[model samples]
Target: MPIRRRLGYLPALVLIFFLCVLLYAFQLHSLISTSRSIDGIEQTADQLDNYKDEPPNKAQLKLQNSPLENEADTADKALLESPVQDWVKFVRLSDDIFLYSVILDLRDGNMDYPCVRIVAIVRRRQSITCNFAGNSSVAASFYELSENHGLSYGAFVLSCKIPQQIKPETVTSFIVQQDETKTYVNVQYTVTEKVPPSMPLTYGICIPVLYGSRYGAANLVEFMELNRIIGAGHVFIYLQHDRLSAEMIKVVNYYKAKRMLTTLEFKLPVSEQIIWYYGQLLAIQDCLYRNMGFAKYLAFQDLDELFVPYSSENIVSMLNPLFSANSSLASLRIPTRYIKASEEELAHPPLAMKLTMAAEAEDVLFTKCVVRPEMVFEQGIHHTSRVIQHHYQTVALPSSFGQLHHYKNYPSSVSNERVPKTYGKKFLARYEQVISELQVKS
Candidate 1:
C-alpha cells in the first residue's frame, strides 16, 4: 500500500514543475516586447530631430542673396582663402627688397584713374610686377623718393593702375613679382581705403624710427608733455623693438595706455647693411598716407624738436590765421633754432626752461613742416616732395610768429643767444602739471 501512494505523488509533482516553467517563459516574452517598443520610440525621436521644414519664402531668399551680402561673402571667402600675414610687418620679396604696405588711392579728384600705391624699401634697378585679383597682372611704375641719402637701398612708391573691368573697392590682395627673380611675394597689407571724410584729431605728429638705446623715459616724457602743451592731439613713434631699452618700452606703454601715442614696431630686413635711418623715409610716407583724411594738420619732427608758438598759446591758434589768410597753403615751413643743452641740463626735469640759449635761426641746416595731409602726396624728412599740384602751396613761416626748437649738442664756435620768452612761462606751468600727473600715475 505505501509503494502505490509514493508513485501517485510523482505525477502531481511533475505537473507543478511544468506549470512553473510556462509562467517564466511568458514573463521573458513580455520583457522582450517592451524593449522592442522603447527602441522604436527612440528611432521616431531621431527622425523628428532631423526632419527638414519647407523652403524659405521669396522675400527671405532675396534678403539672403542681396548684393551687399554677396559682396561681403566674396570678401570673406577671399580673406579665408588667402595666406595669413601680419598687416604691420614688412614682407620681404628679394634679398634687397622689402614691401611695407599697400594703400588704395581714391583721392577726391583722382577717382577716374584709381590705383594702388605700395610703400617699399627696394633697390632702384629692380623691376616689379603687380598681380591683381582675377589673375590680371600689370607692370608697376616706380617712383623713388628723393630723400634716400645715396643709400644702396631707398624708399620707393610702387603704383599699379586698376583694370577698367574690375572695381577698385573689391581689390583686396595682390602678389608682387620681380623681373629678375621667379619668386612671387604676397603683399602683407590688404589694400583698403583708410581715408574718411573727417576725423576727431586736430593735430598729429609723426616721429621717425627711434633706434638705438639712446632715448629713455625722460626724453619721452619731456617730448610728450611739450607736444601736449602745444596742442598735439596724437603722436606716432616708429620703434626699433630689439634696440629699445626696457625703460623706454615702459614709457611707450604708458603713453599708449593714455591713448596719446601710437608706437609701431619698425625693423628693416637689412638693418645691418642700411645707412643711418634710411628706412625713415618709408616710415614717414607710411605715416603720411595713414594720417590722410584723419588729422586736420600733421607735423613731422624728431623727439628732440618742438614747434613753439610765439604769438599764440597753441599751434592751432597760430595755424588758423595762416590757413584763413591763404586758401591755397598746404604746408608751413617752420624755421628751426638748434639749442645746445649740457648733460646736467638735459637730466633735469624741464628741458625747455633750463636750455634757454639757442643758435641763430639762420643757421638752420634743414627745416620741418606742418602740412594738410590730404593735400600732400609724399613727405621728406624736412619738406614735402609732392603735393596735389596747383591746388596747394608751401609757405615759409616767419620767425617772429613761431619756430621749431631743436635741442642738440653743438660746437663751441656757434653763437648762443637766449630764446624768445613769449611762451616760456606757459610752457613751464604746463610742464610742471604734466610731471605731477605722471608721478601720480606711477
Candidate 2:
C-alpha cells in the first residue's frame, strides 16, 4: 500500500518541476528581447545625432559606391564658398617669407582646404602665385607643434614663400582660392614702414606673448614705458589672444598708433592654447627675420626684464659706451640681477608709487640678450644662434656698468612661491620717471 501511494505523488512533483522550468525560460527570453530593444534604440539615437551634426556630404564621401558627380558638385560648391575670409590673416615674416594662419574649423563645418596656389597682387601690376601643396607638410608640422604645446585644435601656420623680386613692403594683400571648389579667402597684409629712414638701423624689442592672467595692467604699462624710456626705439609685440585689459590695450594702441610699436595678432584659439611655450621661439625667430632689414638691433627679453644702467641715465646712454668700445660686437649678453620683494613690501604694496621700490635682493637670474637682427639665423628663448656661415659672438656686459632688473625673485602673488629673502637697497631709481609717466598715462 505505501509503494503505490509514493508512485501516485511522483507525477505531481514532476509536473511542478516542468512548470518552474517553463516560467524561468519565459523570463529569460523576455529579458534578452528587452536588452536587444534597448541596444537598437541607443544605436538609432547615435545615428540620428551624427546625421544632424555631421555634413551629409562627408558621409556620402565615405561610401564605396558614392557618385563621383555628386562629390564634384559638392567640391565645386565648396570652392565657390568663401569661409576663410573671416579667419585668414597674413603677416609679413620677411621680404621673401610671409606667415599665413588659417583656422581649420572642421569640427564646426565641412570647410575644404584652400588652394595650393596662392596669389599676391602687388600694386595691381605684378601677380605672384606659388603652388604651396608641397609645403602642406610644413603646415602639418605646425599642427603637431601646437599639439605638443598642448593645443587641442588644428591650425595651419604657413611660412608662405614669396618671390625674391617682389618687395613684401610694397604688397598690399594676398588672395587664397580653391580653384576646384571655387571658394576663396582674402588676407590683407599691412605694409607700413615701421622704422624711419633716418633711424634705419633702429633697435626694437620683440615680446611674443600668448594670453595669460598674470600680466597685470599697471605692470604692462610701466614695462612698455620703461623700455621706451630706455633704448628700445620700436616694440614688436605678438599677442596670441586679444583678451587683454583696457589699460593694456591703451598702452599698446598708444605706441602702435605712433608707429613706435608693431603689434601682430596670433590667432590661436584660447581653447587650443598649450603650456609648452615653443611659440615664443617661433615668435622670436619671426621677429628677427621680419625686422632683418628694418631694425639694426633686436632685443629678445620679457616685458618684466628691464635693462638698466648703473651710472648712465638710460640704456641708449649706457650702450653708447659699448658701441664706442666694440664696433664689431654682434650681440650683447646682459646679466640678469633678480630683485626680490620683501615681506613688508608684498604686504604694503607700493603699486601706487614705484612698484620696483619694493625690490630688495640681488639674486642671480637668467641671462637676457640684445642681438643684431641680420646676424641671427635662429633664436632661442634666452639667446640666439648665429647664421651658418657666421660664428656666434657676444659681449658680456659687466654688472657694475648695469644689468637686467628682473622682478621675478620677489615674493609676488603670481609665480614664485619661495619665501623671498631681504637683500636690501634698490637699483631702479632712474626708472622712477618712466614708472611715474606710466602711472599718469594709465
- The candidate scoring highest on lDDT is 1
lDDT of each: 0.69, 0.47
lDDT of 1 at 164: 80
In the range 1-442, model 1's lDDT, one tens digit per residue, is 7998989999899999999999999999999999999998786565444321112232222222213322121222222222322125678777767888677775543322467778888765577787787788878888788887777788888888878878877766677788655434433333234444555567889997786645567678878866776777778887766676666656776665445677777777776456436488888887787766666789999887888877686788999899878877889888887788765555554566667666654444489999988777778888877785557788888887788887777543354333335445766675566556555221
lDDT of 2 by residue, 343-440 (tens): 34333322223344323334333576777654444455655444312343666778777667665435533332121111111213433443465553
lDDT of 1 at 417: 31
Collision pairs in model 2: 79-181, 79-182, 79-183, 80-181, 80-182, 80-183, 341-410
Error of 2 at 367 (Å): 1.5
Q: What is the number of backbone collisions in each predicted candidate, taken in the order shown?
A: 0, 7
Worst 10 residues of 1 by lDDT: 71-80
In model 1, what is the error at residue 415, expressed in angstroms? 11
Candidate 2 ranges with C-alpha deviation above 4 Å: 1-198, 269-275, 324-328, 342-365, 410-442
Instruction: Give the lDDT of residue 208 in candidate 2.
Output: 67
